[model samples]
Structure formats: structure tokens, C-alpha cells
Target: MRYFGGLVHAIGSFARDRSGNFAVLFGMVASVLALGVGFAVNVSQLYNAKSSLQGVVDAAVTSTARDLTTGVIKEADANKSVQAFLDANSRAGILSADQIVLDKLTVDRTANTVQADVHVDLGLYFPIFSVGDMKRVAASTTAVYSDKTIEVAMMLDVTGSMAANWWAKTDKIGDLRTAASGAVEDLLDNNLDPKNPRVRVAIVPYAEAVNTGGLASTVFVEARYGSNVPPPIDAPVSVSLTLAPDKCATERKDKDGYADYSPDGPNTPRLDNDGKTYLAKVNRDDHMKTCPKPELIPLTADKQKLLDTITDFRADGVTAGGIAAQWGYYMLSPSWRSAIADAALGAGPANFDKKKVAKVAILMTDGQFNTAFAGGRGAPRSQNAGQKSRSNAEGICSNMKRDGIEIFTIGFDLDDPSMTMTERDQAKSVLKNCSTADTSSLKHYYEAATGTELAAAFDEITENIEKLAIQR
Candidate 1:
């Protein structure tokens, strides 16, 4: 009877003992913690799956949109393109490829948009105390494809400095030609269409002056004679006397009733205060000397002609970047559209419409603006100028930007061996200021130290242009 009583007492003590309470409490806490950890793991997996699916969907839609804009594929092939991209970038660990479902793939031709909706059934890493073992994740993306018309004016520097060697290359001019041709190909390759090409390129090879060539009479007020004797004021001169073999043109003076940086028409004659013609001054003895002989090619979709023009580039003359920049702007200006049409270069829209067209100017220079001329009709000549040209360039750049023309400036080996650091900095600063402001989506300035770097710069610009053309 005593032994039975002791066993009962021991059982009662054990049940009332506080020392074993910790183990029971820890067990309860651990169960909850394990469930929380399991839920977190599943949540993390879902998040990862969502991100991966979203990336794939975005890429697929973007690719489809680009292909559609380029006419590389039709609406029927958009689904195939999206599927192929998704298959190529399958996230098997986070979400099974087989479980991924493309719910919708749409191409709106009228809207020029591509949209995709995707869903994935992601298997949970830990499904303890969960409603289901798998979670559904979805992603949707839309991309707009534009078929806007693109006009590009490429202003290249063909000065005497281009004759120097470029990064072990035989000739810097040759490297420039190669890089420029490559950029043209990148932008215009497969761009031709029978109805209307999406892109047109114009080349303005400039040095001391821009060569208007056959378009001079159409665009300029009057052709200047090569001789020092100013032609009789208000008297008609023979076209032969006025025309020169090398079509180097001087910038019109501000006093000629033409705004300092405004585009001029034939009716607006750039004449002296006395209403006399201003002859194109030739500082050098050789008539064709120091001239970038390649005539400017206006906006044209003829790729072969562009390539041929690039191939035929010859480097000469001093650097007059301001004049070159002005001509670059003119190439894209709607005011000059009629001039271009009359010259048989190409046709432009009747008016400037930013919604339907994108105008871009790529101005490249290898040196500073060291040469400039002011005054005519036996007036005291102002020569070997500097600040005047730079200021003019800045004004022109500001005007072009104000008119909604995108300006891109490239400083190719702008550092002069003879210049001080301050001078070099000034030169670069001027060029940078002349370019359009750098933004998140667009880069307007580039500095290339070597030929390879120059090529890379051109390539980058071409890629940007292509993106702009497709996403307008």
C-alpha cells in the first residue's frame, strides 16, 4: 500500500514540475518558427520566379516589336518570335519551362504595338501549412513599334589634319571613311522599301568650307568670282566667271539681311551693305587646294550612292567646324527642302512635322576652328579667326536644338599637340556645349582618341539612331 502511494505522488510531482516546462514551450515555438521559415522560403521562390518570368516576357515583347518595326518579320511570326525567345531563356530552376504558359501574344498593326502576357506555375520549395504546393505568377509587357521617317545629316571633318596617322593606321582619313561607311551600313542596311524608305542619309564633308557643288546657285544668293576685283555692283556677271571648280563657299555675313545663323534662299541674296556680291575668298594659291572635294550629298535613301561618296572622300583644308555645323543643320532644315528637291538630291516633306519625321545631325571634327573670314567688297579682311567662329557655332547649335533637331557632336583627336592644356580643354568644351544635352535615353557627345575608338563611337551612335528610328 505504501509503494502504490509513492508512485502516485511521484506522478503528481512530475506533472507539476516547472523544470520540464521549457521543453514543451520550446517545442511549440519551434513548430511556429518552422512554419514561418517554410512560408518565407516559398515566398522567396515565388518572388524569384516572378522576376525571371517578367524579364523573359519583356525581352520577348521587345524583340518582337523591333522585328516588326524593321519589317524583318510579319505579325503572324510575332508569336513564334516570342516563343523562341522564351524558350531560349527558360528559368527551369525557379519555374518549370513546361509549366510556363503564354496566355496572350498580340500585335496591333494600326497601333504599332506588341504586347505579351505570360503565366507560370512555380512549384514551392516548401509548402508546409500552405493551401497549395504551387503558386501562380504572371507578367505582362507592351512595346510600341514606330515606322517614322528618319533624316540624318552626317557632317564629317575632312581637313588637312586628317592626313596624319591614326593609331598605327596608314591614314586617319581612311579610318574615318571606314568608320563612317560602317555606321551608314548599320543604320540603312535592309532599310530600303519600294514605297518609302524609313531612313535617309545626307553627307556633308567639310573642311575650311562646305562644298555646295551643283546646289550652289539654288541655295546661295550669288556665286563669288575667284579674282580680287569685286564684280560691278548690280551688274550681271557671266556664270563661268562666278563658278569655281572647287565649290568652297564662304559663310554669309550677318549684315546681308540674313540672320547670323539662318538658312538663306536664292531670293535672300547675301550681299554687301552697298548691295554688291561677296566673292568667295581664296587664301591659298591653288584653286582646288585645301578643299574637301567630295560634294555634299543631300538626304537620299540610295545606299550605294552613300557608300560611293564615302569611298571617294579626300581630306584637305583647314578646320572650320562652325560652317560645317551650319551646313549640317541646313541639310535637315525644312526650309532647304525645296532647294534639295530643285537640286535633284532628294525630296523632303512640304513642311517640318516633328510627329512624322525625326531630324538628326551628327557633326564630327578633328581640330579646332582656326580659320574664318569676315568682310567683303574691298573692306578690311578679318582672317585667322577663333572666338567668332566658336560663338557662331554655339548659336547655330542652340537654334537647331530649339527647332527640334537633335545634334550629336564628336571630337575626334581634338587635342592639338601644340596647344596648351587650357586651350585643349576650351576646344573640347566648345564641342560639348554644341551637342545636345546628354539625357537618360540619348548621348549627344563623344570623344575618340584613336581610330578604333572612333569606330566604336560611330557604332554606338548608329545603334542609338536605330533605336530612335524604331521606337519613335
Candidate 2:
């Protein structure tokens, strides 16, 4: 009887023991931690899937929009384009490739917009505590593609400065040609239709003077001369000199005594005080030496012709950026449509609607605008032409911008190694002033320090132009 009573007391004491409480509490805490960790891991995976899906959607919509803007793909094909892009990029890491679904694609031709919605079923890495094994993640993206027609006027500087051999193991002018041509190809590739392309390009190669070549007679008035002996009517004699007819052109002056920067049709050709037409004359020494004689090629979609003209360019002449800028503006001006047509350059657009057409000028120069000469065949060079040239260039830029023409200025190796810092700063300042204000996150000014850099700058400009072309 006593043994039985002792066994009951021991059982009672064992049931009241507090020494084993820590083990039970630790077990409960561990269970809760495991569930929390599993839920967190699954949530992280879902977040990652969402991010990946969003990226795919964004890329697909952007590419489709670009192709649509360039007319590479029709609205009916937008869904195909997006699906193809997604298929090419889809992987089996965060999101299953086969689970990706293009929920909807909407294309508004009139609005020039492309929108896409995509959904993906993502399998959870750790489905714990009654959570589901899979979740549906979705993403939507929209892109607005501009349908505006693009007209580009490339005003290149073929001055003597471009011939400098300072660029390490590379010719500056050659680099420029390659870069400019590459830009042309990029802007027009897959973006043109033979019947009605959305893009057209013009080239204005300028030096101390702009050579009109075969188009000179059509644009300039008859040449006249002034002699030492006074004529019967107290006027200079009308003399015909034996010279190349397609050699040069006189600068157009504004009626307000400022540089004639307005693209208001052809200016009345200047005349000497003797009522004789003034002829454009180059320095006798630089006539054939430094003058780039390529006539300006007006707006055209002929890629081969444009490339050929750029390749055939030879660096010769003084930097006349103002004249080049003016010519660039003229190429896009509605007023000069008749002149362009008469010269057979190309049929100019009937009208310029800022909403439907984008007029852009790419002005590139390697040196300061420091040369200006009088109109006569052998007129003396101006003493203070550098300042005047800069002033004239700024005036032209202002006028062009006022007309809604976008200007992009490039200073290629403008900092002469042998020149002073002040001079280099001045050159850069001139180019900066000539460039239009930055708009839509696109900068209008660039400076290249080397030939490779110059080429890269042109390529960057080309990209910006392309983006601008497809995005309003």
C-alpha cells in the first residue's frame, strides 16, 4: 500500500515540473519562423516575376511603336511584332516562357500610339502555410509614336581646318564623312517607302563661299564689273571675265542691314554701286586649293546619292558657318520650294506644318568662322570678319529657330592644340550660341575632341534625330 502511494506522489511532482518549459517554447517559435521565412521567399519571387514581366512588356511595346512609326510594320502587324519580341526575350528563370500571354494589343493609327498588356503565370518557389503554388502577374505598357515627316539639312564644314593631321592616326575629315554617312544610313534605314518616304535629307557643304555649281545661274543675277575709268553714265563698266561659271555665289544681305538669315525666298541679288550685278569671288590662292566645290544637294530620299556626295566631299575652303546655316535653313523653307524645284534638286513640300513636319539642321564646324571677303572677283578680305561671321551665324540661328526649325550644332576639334584657351572657349561659345535650346531631353550642342569622338557625336545626334522623328 505504501509503494503505491509513493508512485502517485512522483507522478504529481513530474506533472508540475517547470524545468522543461524552454524546449516547448522554442519549438513553437521555430514553427512560426519557418512559416514567415517561406512566405517572404515566395513574396520576393513574385516581386521578381512582376519586374521581369514589366520589362518585357515595355520593350515589346517600344520596339513595336518604333517599327510602326517608321512604317516598317502596319497596325495589323503590331501584335505580331510584340509577340515576336517577347518570344525572343522570354526565358525560364523567373517567369515561364510558355506561360507568357499577350492579353491585348491596341494600335491607334490616327493617334500614333501603341499599347500592350501582358500576363504571365509565375510558379512560387515556396508555397507554405496554405498559400497557392502559382500566382498571375501582369504588366501593361504604352508608347506614342510620332507620324511627323522629318526633313534634315546637314550643314558640314569643309574648311582648311578640317585638313589638320592632329588627330592621332586618323584623318578628321575622313572620320566626319564616315560618321555623317553612317548617321544618314541610320536615319533612313527601314524608314523610307519608295513612293512616299517619311524622311528627306539635304547637304550643304560650305567654305569661304557656297558653290552653287550648275545651279548658280538659276539662283544668282548676272555678274558685273567696276573699272578704274568712269563710264559715260558715271557708273562702273560692265565687263565679262573669263571664269568658271559654276564657281561661287555672293552672300545674301538682309534688308534691315543684318545678315539675310530669313528663308523668305531668294534675296534680290546684290549689285555694285554702278548698277552692275556682283559676282561671288574666292581668294585667288584658295580658288582650287581649299574650296569644296560640291553643289548643295537639296532634300531627297536617294540614299545612294546622298552617300556618294558625302564620300566625294574634299576638305577645302575657309569656315563660313553662317552661310552654311543660311543655306541649311533655305533647304527646309517653303519659300525656297520654287528654287529647289527649278534647280531640280527635289520637289519641295507644298507646306510646312509644325505638327506634321519636323525641320532640322545639323551644323558642324571644326574651326571659328573667321573668313569673309567682298563680292567682286578679287575683292580684299575683310579685316574684322571673324566677329562679323559669328554675329551673322547667331542671327541666322535665331531666325531659323523662330521659324520652328530645330538646330543641332557640333564643334569637331574646335579646340586647336596650338591656340590659347581663350580662343578655344570662344569657338565653343559660338557653336553653343548657334545651337537651339535643349528640348524634349535632347541636347542641341556637342563638342568632339578627336576623330573617333567626332564620329561618335554624329552617331549620337543621329539617334536623337531618330527618336525625335518617331516621338512628338
Give the top-scoring candidate (TM-score). 2
Question: What's the TM-score of each model vs. the native?
Answer: 0.75, 0.77
The reply for model 2, stretches above 4 Å from the true place, is 1-42, 122-134, 164-170, 225-244, 254-258, 267-291, 349-351, 373-383, 417-425
The lDDT of each candidate is 0.73, 0.73
- Model 1: per-residue lDDT, tens digit, 346-371? 78432456656778889888777765
**Inter-residue clash pairs, candidate 1:** none
lDDT of model 1, residue 162? 87
lDDT of 2 by residue, 1-472 (tens): 9999999999888678756866787789998998899889988998888888888889889998888778788777889999999898787447766667999998877777888988887777777657578778888989998778889999998876676476555477788888889878977786547668888888888888776654554333323442321122333444333344445553554221234555766533444455654332211212222446677788888899889988877877777666777678778889878776876777874366777888889999888777543222222345366766676678778888888888899988766676577767877888899888888679889989887788888888877877777655
Q: How close is candidate 2 to the true structure, as a TM-score?
A: 0.77
